[model samples]
Target: MASNKPALEGPVATVAPADNLPYGHGLGESGEAERSWGEWNPTEETVRPVRGRHRVAKQRGLARSSTVLGVGVIAAVGAGGIATAQDKPAVSISLPDVIADNLPDATSLPGMGSSSTAERDTASEVLAQAPLTSAGLTAADSEQGTTAGEALRARILQQAEQQQAEADATQKAATETAAAVEAASQAKKQQTAAEKEAAEAKAKAKAEAEAKAEAERLAKLAASYALPTSSYTITSTFGQAGSLWSSGQHTGLDFAAPTGTPVKAVHSGTVKSAGWSGSYGYRTVLELDDGTEIWYAHQSSMTVTAGQKVSTGDVIGRVGATGNVTGPHLHLEVHTAGGAGVDPMAWLNGKGINP
Candidate 1:
């Protein structure tokens, strides 16, 4: 230790005396360090413990600054100094009262207030109180206490439910479309069937109307004509090939009856002849207005004279065996306007009169 260094000012630390000092060095009265140690030995009894007054000099308002400086000085020392300091008793380091009172609270630091743990917990609680299912959400869910993990679980569930709802809506739309198509098809088919049925019914009604008209025409014709004679049986028809016929084939219809049966005119006409025909015996010939001729042969007597007007159903003669016949009968014949003989039965049918 050197004794030539100048003493520091203000509140210096005091050291205890060495028990065995060199011959010339000693503690001056009033506890003054008179000389520095040259060759001295220290013992437990001679060494005094450092007390409260042993402290660094106060820098007035620069207390915190002085503390910081002291810590810097300790750090600047080399590792050997640190090892020597380790051999000493452990020392307690504390901030000055005035410096600690002037420091700000830890919670007031930047990034520590708004982003505090209390705020984080409140956010987690809000999320956790939300409904777990996406099907619905209501304001009342917040009444329940909540947790962070539950909030996350609720969010996942809500997303899954939303996706499922979308899928269900899409499927429902598709099903409705299919149903609409089916209904339209069915309606179209029914309409077509109805149209076809209506067409068939119209055709049937038209055919029935035509048939009724034809029947009315036949009825009118039947009223205008009549059978030649009553109580008579058809014996032979025109075009009958037999040995008894003079022309090799019969040219008339034979109506067989008892002698003196009355014969009537078939239609309104004038008598053309009332005299005897050679093979026809006593015959009567009547000519219609259209030049068609009707002959009544094999008659016993004639009531219509030549050029006499006779109406339909007027008595004209009597059936007899006068013609070339084996029994009493009237031979009736029909001739077209050209004098061509036709079947009498067919001619009568054409007039709507069937014998």
Candidate 2:
């Protein structure tokens, strides 16, 4: 009989078993399967070469290549997962069926020396690149805040300087105004003082001039007049009340003296009358240059005739007891040009004589 076993280098072929074989063929009498078949007997047909063996080898080789490619993809993904886990926000990751003894320490990985050193290096790299992310945004905000604070400080300083300048200007203006006002007040006071001094000087000069003119007038009047008699006593004054006279008041001034005392002319004048009258025992009337009359009554005797010119101090009559007289006296009377009697004392004072 020919054997149906396929060769190792040939294509595999399907073989049908005999339908007549018992359920427990090639077993022992107890129907147990054989534990061992020591040797196989192959015929010539079992060892024959088969076709399409190269195609089968090629397929198997392609399947093995695909499996190796899948394993490489899985290793690449695991490395990416480790990096992703480090980059994510801190959290716990549980790996199933992974024992602590089977896992490698992160520091023992390739190109990683120690855990603290790697973490420090990673933090330095993150800080260096922080400007591109949210960390960078925080840094930018802080810088802006600092800039704003500096600007505000500068503005405040500028305002303070401006206010100080304005205050200085105001103070300077006030000082200038006060100085001007004080100067003006001083000038006004000096002007007023000068004016007052001038007024006082003018008043003093006017008073001196008036006194000089009065003295010159009195000297001129004194040179033109003289008293009527010397050594005579005034017994009665003009305008005296006396019942002895014909009028109720005496109209002449009386000078009492001894009989025959010489009476002189009071001024240069013409004699208007010199003769005895009823009440006047002896009388004389003298006419002055201005037509005023001077009467010498109660005279003892008359030395001048009517119409005779007499000089001042010339003897015109003698004093004696005359008309209605109690003793010897000279009664002198003055009359104006219109025949009005005047006080002889006042008339003598006007001529610059006291009596």
lDDT of each: 0.73, 0.69
Candidate 1 pairs with clashing backbones: none
The TM-score of predicted model 2 comes to: 0.50
User: Highest TM-score among the candidates is held by which one?
Assistant: 1
lDDT of 1 by residue, 1-355 (tens): 1112122222212232333233424558754435433211223443345544543343323433644433333333322323333444444445456555655554554345756777788879987875555433334434454444565578789889999999999999999999999999999999999999999999989999987987788788888899999898898988999889977899999898899999999999999999889889999999999999999998999887999999989999998888577999999999989999999999999888999
Candidate 1, position 178, lDDT: 99
Which residue pairs clash in candidate 2? none
- Model 1 score (lDDT): 0.73
lDDT of 2 by residue, 222-260 (tens): 666777776789888888897988888889888888898
Residue 219, candidate 2: Cα error in Å is 1.5
Off by over 4 Å in 1: 1-182, 246-248
Top lDDT hit:
1
All candidates: TM-score: 0.55, 0.50
RMSD of each: 15.8, 21.9
User: What shift in Å separates residue 17 of candidate 2 from its native position after superposition?
Assistant: 52
